[model samples]
Target: MNSPMFTRTSQQESAIQTNKVLRNTYALLSMTLLWSALVAGVSMAMNLPRPNIIIMLVGFYGLLFLTEKNRNNSMGLVFTFLFTGFLGYTTGPLIGAYVSADMGDLVVTALGGTALSFLAASAYALTTKRDLSMLGGLMLSLFVVLVVGMVASIFFQSPVLSLALSSLFIVFSTMAILMTTQGIIRGGETNYISATITLYVSIYNLFISLLSILGIMNDD
Candidate 1:
């Protein structure tokens, strides 16, 4: 059996490691977000055509898989930026559409909302010691439902259903932020790269969903 001092020292070391991971994750996440924004801005200025849905889906999932598979190495960081840049590029057409429609203000508003929501969720998770692990299963279920709803709405094209799905995605994204933050604090997520990717994707979805709702509401 270990002495009390040994156990105490081990705990302290673990705490330090967790803090380092958290700090690195946040640092990388900020840089990736800025990089993504820059790419999106360039894409918008070029007025690039949006990739087809099939192409978008393939690129997203393929890059995401590569990122996760390499999360322990430098390649993870490379793939993370690639995946995020791809996503940002894909969003450029939507931004162009909103600007063309003279609804640019709505994009700003949605971005503000997404940022505020993320801060709130992250703060609560950090300040509270509550174990958010229980939320994992529930979040997974909600995610599946959200995906099904999104796919169905694509086919049915009902405004009410689409709005409801957007609302659901907002909730899912907020909970995901909370869960991801808590996972890091609890040391369940040891890899900062994976954590950054998860949080980035959540924020990305949150912004897109909010923008969709705003666009629908402002439709003339």
Candidate 2:
């Protein structure tokens, strides 16, 4: 009998399909990341300052959200890449400052750690096929708290508060990794694009949080 869901394909064919999806995801991810770095470099060359951070950050989020919501088409990929590039430009000042600092190399270290952690999380999720949908609400709440905390900190400007937030973000990002990993494993076949975006965000935010922590510790 023919299945309504997926056709009964041979193991080799299934493997080929899975590999193709993964390959496209990785290729797009890598290309976008490279473009992001290039954009950051070009922005710096144009003498863009960090004080313009708010506009860049807000714009990136706003546009990315809108773009990603409609990201199933070609335009979605274009916006995703553009959003990533803007994010790189926004983060470049921080990256530059971090490198200029005495312990700036910590950024690179955090990046390596984040990469390893992301890989491990994804691999585990793919193998286990466990559902992590439970984390959706929790993750949403965490982000809300972080956003509120940041707004409050504008007036507070307490280094201690900043440290606490950085630490919390680092922890929360790690948790997000788990949720995304599980989703990737359980639903990888159904929506590879969404899964790829989810995984990319998890890794990117993890690196940012780790960078925050490293930069903070260096400041102290």
What are the models' TM-scores?
A: 0.97, 0.80
User: How many collisions per candidate?
Assistant: 0, 0
Q: Give the true-structure RMSD of model 1.
A: 1.0
Candidate 2 lDDT by residue in tens digits, 82-164: 67777777767777766666555787798798888777766765676456667678878988999999888989988788878
* Winner by TM-score: 1
lDDT of candidates 1 onward, in order: 0.91, 0.70
lDDT score, candidate 1, position 9: 100
Residue-level lDDT tens digits of model 1 in 114-163 = 99999999999999978888888989899899889978987898888988
Candidate 2: clashing pairs of residues: none
Candidate 2 minimal-lDDT segment of 10 residues: 183-192
Best by lDDT: 1
User: Candidate 1 regions off by >4 Å?
Assistant: none
